[model samples]
Target: MTTDILTVSCPSKRGIVATISSYLASQGCSISDSSQFDDVETGTFFMRVSFISEEGKPLSEIAEGFTRIGAEWNMNFEFHDSTTRMKVILMVSRFGHCLNDILYRWKIGMLPIDIVGVVSNHFNYQHLVLSHNLPFHHIKVTKDNKAEAEAELMAIIERTQAELIVLARYMQVLSDELCRRMPGRVINIHHSFLPGFKGAKPYHQAHKRGVKLIGATAHYVTAELDEGPIIDQETIAVTHAQSADDYVSIGRDVESRTLARAIHAHIHHRVFVNGDRTIVFPASPDSYAADRVG
Candidate 1:
């Protein structure tokens, strides 16, 4: 009854699936769900399997046993205990819609992540963040001391031992050094109005342009500022009659849901970065079951 997750990636070859499934069966594990992908263009293979150890074997032992198979196939693989929650750090600025939505989901156990702390450049949401019994660190950033500010932020990340950082609506651009240090650990969410609408009041710009679609993108943050590898995206149909304010309201909903979905896939080990794109596997059975219903 104890579920375990196994994720594997390697060069494309035949019998990869048979080898993995046979290995699991040999270890007395029952496969509950499985997803796989073979990228013909890249000649790469990716697989994620959710299974239960019928014999209640420890994760370390199972992982150790898989080394032979992994070595034979020249594969990069990981074995994870599904019950362990991923540690996460949330960074936000003035906008709190995505932050608020993630907070609600975490509070209700709908999101299985340990929100270790929140980092912010502004103090606007200090009270809101603290109310959740989470630590809040306020590190002000300016053009003059961006490097110093990043150092302080890195200290917090080290202290908390966070595995992932979510930029709900953090407005500051990260340095290339930081991006290179932790490649896929940071995720950011923003309204998808680029090229059509730029700075502040994007919804207004969309309204003026008579746009028929409004959307949001959640992606891994890279040095290129919003050009990171996209993990998820969602769009909503907009009518010409809707005002800019209506656009903002609808866009907020889309942003929250898209970011949440991306985070869920990430923490569940169902997402893989494949070159500039991604390979996101479907959720396993009961993966979305919340601890409590509102």
Candidate 2:
């Protein structure tokens, strides 16, 4: 039984679900799990459907057949074979907690992504990235050579034909051009404190203010620094007793988990970019199944 997923987004209209369901059934596909949203304010409809092809129809056939429905609804749609893993490129700076966590998940088949390569501005994680038999690119970025560095980075992206770029604690701010070019294709993770805790040792500042909650945000990278459409977020309760160091430690765990969840939602096609926000659908029943228990 081959499983396939179909994602559709378009202007809201009547009979969209019925039409889609009918078409899938006409093709001998049985829907296993489905999610849809109708935005009343925006008048946009989003849907994701996971189905099993009882007749074992090829994806191309199913997609080609759906073109009629797509055309009728003026929908932007995609059909994905559930077994196909999305290719991803990871960018990281000196921080390795998120990088390390992603690597472990990828290694254990928990992430289910093909990590084409790792790009870093420093040599800190060169050895670790290589240990996994993955190519490591060291493209140092300086104020004077920022453009050149990004060019080199784009070259890698094109060469690998990577589908997504994950900035797992990458420190440098990407240029507006790069951000515009990638749009929702690039994801970044950072501490959730912004505006309140501006610069340098944010945890320490939070400690001084006696903040009760610490969290991380994973969002699609945009031109306006960290102000992109958020995909996932998590927070941990903190008390007055915990020190700044404890905040950092707990925040690291939150960041890693939040980033991983964001990546999972993205690779599985569960996220839809709405206006300034996002429409994230729930995961399928088997989405969390890893190949092995480690």
Candidate 3:
């Protein structure tokens, strides 16, 4: 059987899922997975469905036939075969926590992406990346040669055909040109939840501010620096008894997973951009569970 995945978004209306499911069933498609969300505030409907067909129909046929339903519902729709994987390049300066997290998940088949290479200004993690047989590029950036370095990075982005760039802890601010060029394709993991703690030493800032929570933010990279549309965020408890360094160490775990999950949703096409925020449809956690005690 041939399997195809579809994603759709449109104005809120009754029976959108019924319309889509009925059309697929009529076409001999059997749904294997599905997810949907309704935004009451915006009155928008979004859905993602995966199905299989016994006739081995070509993906093009599925896409083409779906267009009529798309027109009828006035919906924006996209269909793709499940075999495609998004191309991603990782960027880091010296920190390895987030980079290590992504690599581990990718190695275990939890994250779906093609890790083209790892780029860094420092050589700290080159051996670690190379040990996994992934390409590593070292491009040092300084005040005198920042522009040239950015050009070189852009060249690598173009050469590798990377659809998404992840700044795991790249430390350096990107050029406005690159930010504009990439738009919503770049994802950054901020050490803090953001808008609350906004500069360097965010953990320290949190400690100083005496906040009760320490959080992380994963968002699109815009020219505004940490001000782009938010894709995912998570927070953990902190208290007046803990120091700043403690927050940094404790926050590491959440930051990495938060960013990786954001990338996961993105590569799976389960994320949608909406205003300065995002819509993320998560896979069912229960379906992923295993190893029940016998």
Provide the lowest-lDDT 10-residue window in model 1.
Answer: 285-294
Q: Write the per-residue lDDT of candidate 1 for residues 170-198, one digit (tens) a residue.
A: 99998999899889899999777454675
- Candidate 3 lDDT over 15-103, as tens digits, reads 99999999888777888889998989898888988788766777788788888889988999998666676789999998899999999
**All candidates' lDDT scores?**
0.90, 0.91, 0.85
The residue ranges of model 3 lying beyond 4 angstroms of the native Cα positions read 1-3, 40-43, 284-294
lDDT of 2 by residue, 1-294 (tens): 766889999999999999999999999999988999999999999999988889988889999999988999999999998788889999999889999999999887889999999999999999999999999999999999999999999999999999999999999999999888888999999776445875567778888999998888899999987889999998889999999999999989999999999999999899999988999997786465423355
Error of 1 at 55 (Å): 0.5
Report the number of the highest-lDDT candidate.
2
Question: What is the alpha-carbon lDDT of model 1 when measured against the actual structure?
Answer: 0.90
What is the descending lDDT order? 2, 1, 3
TM-score of each: 0.97, 0.97, 0.89
Scored against the true structure, residue 116 in model 2 reaches a CA lDDT of 97
Q: Which residue pairs clash in candidate 3? A: none
Q: Name the regions of candidate 1 deviating beyond 4 angstroms.
A: 193-195, 289-294
lDDT, model 2, position 28: 95
